[model samples]
Target: SVSSRSRISLIASTVTIAGAGALLAPAQSKK
Candidate 1:
């Protein structure tokens, strides 16, 4: 259970970072 929770948290953080990067990428490219 503990391992699964950690795995989920790690995936969540990775997805969040990827999402933020994706959002910023287009804006930066436009600039």
Candidate 2:
């Protein structure tokens, strides 16, 4: 279903953004 696929993509995007934020925090602290 399209709705299910959209939900999955949304979750994937949120996870990617969260992961990127986590990775960026360490670099920001070093500066």
Candidate 3:
């Protein structure tokens, strides 16, 4: 069974990816 810790890890990974994408957008537009 999955633990609450595992759920939090998944959410953290998702947020990291989303943050990276958000950061990348402006850099791309500047080029």
TM-score of each: 0.88, 0.91, 0.73
> Which pairs, if any, clash in model 2?
none
Rank candidates, TM-score, best first.
2, 1, 3
Superposition error at 31 for model 2 (Å): 0.5
Error of 1 at 25 (Å): 0.1
**lDDT tens digits by residue: candidate 2, 1-31:** 9999999999999999999999999999999
Root-mean-square deviation of every model:
0.5, 0.4, 1.7
Model 2: residues >4 Å from true position, as ranges? none
TM-score of candidate 3 relative to the true fold: 0.73
Model 1 misplaced stretches (Cα beyond 4 Å): none
Instruction: Give lDDT for model 3.
Output: 0.96
What TM-score does structure 1 among the candidates reach? 0.88
Residue 12 lDDT in candidate 1: 100
Q: Give one digit per residue, the lDDT tens place, for model 1 in 1-31.
A: 9999999999999999999999999999999
The better-scoring model by lDDT among 1 and 3 is 1
lDDT (Cα atoms) of all candidates against the true structure: 1.00, 1.00, 0.96
